[model samples]
Target chain A: MIATTTENDSAEHPAVPTAEADRPAQSEARRRRLPFSPWHLLLAPIAVLFAFPFVQMIMVSFMPSRDINRLPPRFIPTTVTLDGYRGLLERSDVLIWLTNTVIVSTVAVGSNVVLCSLAGYGFARLRFRGRNVSFLAILGTIMIPIQLLMIPTYVMFARLHLLNSLAALIVPWLATAFGVFLMRQFFLSVPRELEEAGLLDGASRLRILWHIVLPLARPSLMTLAVFTLVGSWNDLIWPVIAISDSNLFTLQIGLANFQGVRRTEWSLLMAGNVVAVLPLLVGFLVAQKHFLATMSSTGLKG
Target chain B: MARSATVAVPEDASTATGAGRRTQRRSEQLAGMAFVAPAVIVIVGLGIFPAAWATLLALQKWNGFSEPRFVGADNFERMSRDTDLVAAAWHTLLYTGLFMPVSVVGGLLLAAALNRRIRFMGLYRTAIFVPYVASAAVTGLLANFVFNPEVGVVNNVFRVLGLPQQGWLEDPSQAMVVLVIMSLWGQLGFVTVIYLAALQDVDTACLEAAEVDGASASQRFRHITVPQVAPATAFVVIWQTIQCIQLFDLVYTTTRGGPIGATTTLVYYLWEQAFRQLSFGYGSAIAWVLFVVTMVMTLVLVAIQRRRGGEQPA
Candidate 1:
């Protein structure tokens, strides 16, 4: 099942090996010969500590409210119930919030992939006046702290009457400078011969990009999509400021408000958190290798 | 089409193809502009345009609604006298001072432990990294429950051990400490992953040579491993510091900048002033200060890294 999923995920860039393929056979042999390492003594406890909150979140989500409210709270509940999930669904706007978050993230990912790739390819492969200058100016925006822009952005959105709507959340995330930068880097590394061959075949630049470049650029596109999705999904402060309407609140804003109003509702809060986090968690688990590889490589490069 | 086909022929037809090539070049330039138009619009309209507007807003006094009256330097003057800003700055400094080193070093140690040929290395790595994949709001929600003063898990453990219970997030003095812990929990995974990748890229030959000699394990780690990961360390530190400076989501969700303002970091303070208090002009002033501080710190860190002969962070 894992192998099949890995294959499906990397279907775009078949020429590049998956993380599993990168593991050497000698490591498997070595693992068998030395099953124990002293690092485990230190690592085991730390891993448990790291994983404890997740375990607790899951366990407490199912715990009865009485059990949660009891003094000296129980790590493992004696009784399990669906009351938390039920309450979250019936009483709160968690479902609406989840849907809104999904819509925002999906739009963010889609726009970033389509737009950043085009811009990145333009900067990487095409010859044009002021291309270098424009790219540098865009890159410089990355250093301008988002905090510095928020107040004015809020005012601008208000003037444009875009505030209190999903557009406020979606517009800022449509195309990021980092996404453009990452895609440009990836396109620069791609061998030019493929595109050159296409040009010789009388293909327009757009046709070449669509047929020859984007397919090879899938890994980078995936990386950009994942980052943008995570960022938009988890965004809080901006939504908290821009969207005052309860009906349009994203999951983070909804959950933050839920916690504020129902501080004592531990089970409900846990279930809300679980719902907010589970999609990304499942995604990470499915493409763990790709996620790790992308993160590390991107961190090193940018 | 004929021009493309003739391009495969010899340069003897260069004069006829030159005009075609020039047109092709012009078309390519137009295509480039067209391709980049959407991204450039968004970047300039949202990112750069708002930034310039922020500079102007910083110079004017507006409560976000009134007609902007030009008040030169008044907002910045207010910032100098704003005690809340000072307190928030101190808290931000304190958070960075504690959070940066702890997370970075913890990440290094964790990465070193996993950088071996062992069973279930993937599992260990995944476990350590899962928190980073979770949203900060979710993490803050969990932290609130786990650190609740009366009925939370930590207090429960304290009771189980017959130790005195202490107020965590609700405590004025300990709120920042709890905030740091929560931030570290979510960020250490990212730092570890970077360090782990760097560790894997370390020269195995050098380590083997050191082992062949009389270098002890700790000595080898210090001499070989530490220096090898310096660039990664620089990257991690700078990243963590930026994150620490922009520390708002966790604070907003958890403490709302505090039990008596103990955990109010710079970004959180700016948010409160601008959004909550409707002090947009003063907030923009604070925002400019933050931008300046971020740039200076980044440059200084990069300079230090370069002086040590480490590669600049990309």
Candidate 2:
């Protein structure tokens, strides 16, 4: 098939004198002087459809509870109020949930970065017995569904007397198989000569890895940190099962509870949802390029 | 230098450097273990061990509290006979069927549509991708409100159009459809971003050549673009299918498998069995089923990916 393709390409190249015109044609296709492509008209409504919910989420967050439940629903808020937030701050345990979420996410991200980098660096540069096998073991777990892990994990956590505490949440997210694989992939790409230079200078492997390999690993490290942070913060299932205490809830769990308690209280629920969503959005916008690259590359590997 | 010299074994220096090299080699081994310990421990303790333990419990008759009795597949036997299990399995399969294709197809189209440079490209991409980054539970919560029969936007739009207003989540008959659409809304962005990345990476030379050969845009896209992005399409399909199989968070927040168990799914049922009903053995059995299903699908995907990746470079 490849031979045929090459043959066809070779044959076709002579037929189009405009082969030299490829670059010009490509540039012409991308010429931004014309922004009014038929695409914009086709996709604008779809874009709006995708974004309108978020807009409505923001708008309804400020709408009074009464306004939300009104027979003829209002897309826009009749009156904006902080009562939704106020209700959370005053009535619910939003503060505890926020702090728990922060603590869990922070520790999870920190530990993932530190431990995954260590594991990655080890797998990449170290020549130790069973390193390949160990690496494969970690990689192998990436496909095991969380549902399968959930039941036994909960039982184990319960056995350890770790349930209802933040420990359960923090431990699992501390070093993910995927994160380790990601970091290992990144570490493998860093020039070995850089580390070898340090090795030749009588430096230890760990020292070289720290001083040489790690500096070049800034992008992967940040991506891993961001991914870990987003995952730990927004994760719902494990936390939902692990911690029954309302006071120990993460942001997502708190929002679920906020909705559960007042099923009709759309305003407060939306506000809670915004709060649950905003940090990751901030993180994503900040690391958009790295996020896009990492999400797709890692996604395909599975 | 010292280690290399030791390996080369200079006659006199060998004795001194041999000790040093052994120490260095030992240290390297220790360093590897030390470096890898935390991650390996976490993976094993939380990941591998749980799956193994779940498998063990799947065959036992443990309620998580009492002495685990050796049931020897009694739970699996009971699970097969369970009515809720059958219905939930069907519901999950139905959900996966409805959800995966729509997500993959819609995602590809959106990706193709947004593939070109246009005005506010970043804005559109960001808007489409927002729902994906947002928490599932949060979106599911928002969906509940959006699909609320009386006061929700969906039914209001239906009423405005003089269509029969469906009691979306509240109605058992319509709940799964509502849930599926909601799931699609949340997940569409993820698949789109994946495809958009894949689409951008699709070989442009072949596409241009096809176009230059007087191929229509649709034909060129169908013949050239589709094959180039086949790996990505396979990826999206597999990933989305796996996601659908383990569907839990959306169901948890939206309907909680309510209105006469219309929307009860596998994981939802597993949670009910293991956590709510305290039927840990039964839940473990279900977990094993989920584990096997997902692992098989993932392995198949990986195999396909490997073959395609090998063939493509040739």
Candidate of highest TM-score: 1
**Predicted structure with the largest DockQ when compared to the true one:** 1
Considering the two chains of model 2, state its CAPRI-style docking category: acceptable
Query: Which pairs of residues have clashing backbones in candidate 1?
Result: none
TM-score of each: 0.91, 0.90
For model 1, state the Cα shift of residue B63 in Å. 1.0
Model 1 lDDT per residue over A16-35, tens place = 22222122355446655545
Lowest lDDT block of 10, candidate 2 chain A:
A13-22
Error of 2 at A15 (Å): 36
Give the alpha carbon lDDT tens digit for every residue of B215-277 in model 2.
877887787777788878888888788888888888888888988899899989999888889
Predictions in order: lDDT = 0.81, 0.77
Candidate 1 lDDT over residue span B1-314, tens digit each: 12123212221111227787877777777777767778877887788889999999899888977798889999989989989999999999999988988998888888777665445665677788888777878988988988988777788888889999889998998888888888888888888878866765666667767767768668878888898889898889888788889999999899988788898899999998888889888889899989988889999999998888644333
Give the chain B TM-score achieved by candidate 1.
0.91
DockQ for the candidate 1 complex?
Answer: 0.41
Model 2 per-residue lDDT tens digits across residues A1-302: 23343344333221111111112355467654655666687788888988887888889889887887777888888888998888767877877988999999998988888789888888887778989888888877886778778888888888889999988888898888888888888987887777765665567666676778888888788778878887888899999999988879988888777677888777778888888887777766665666655566557356
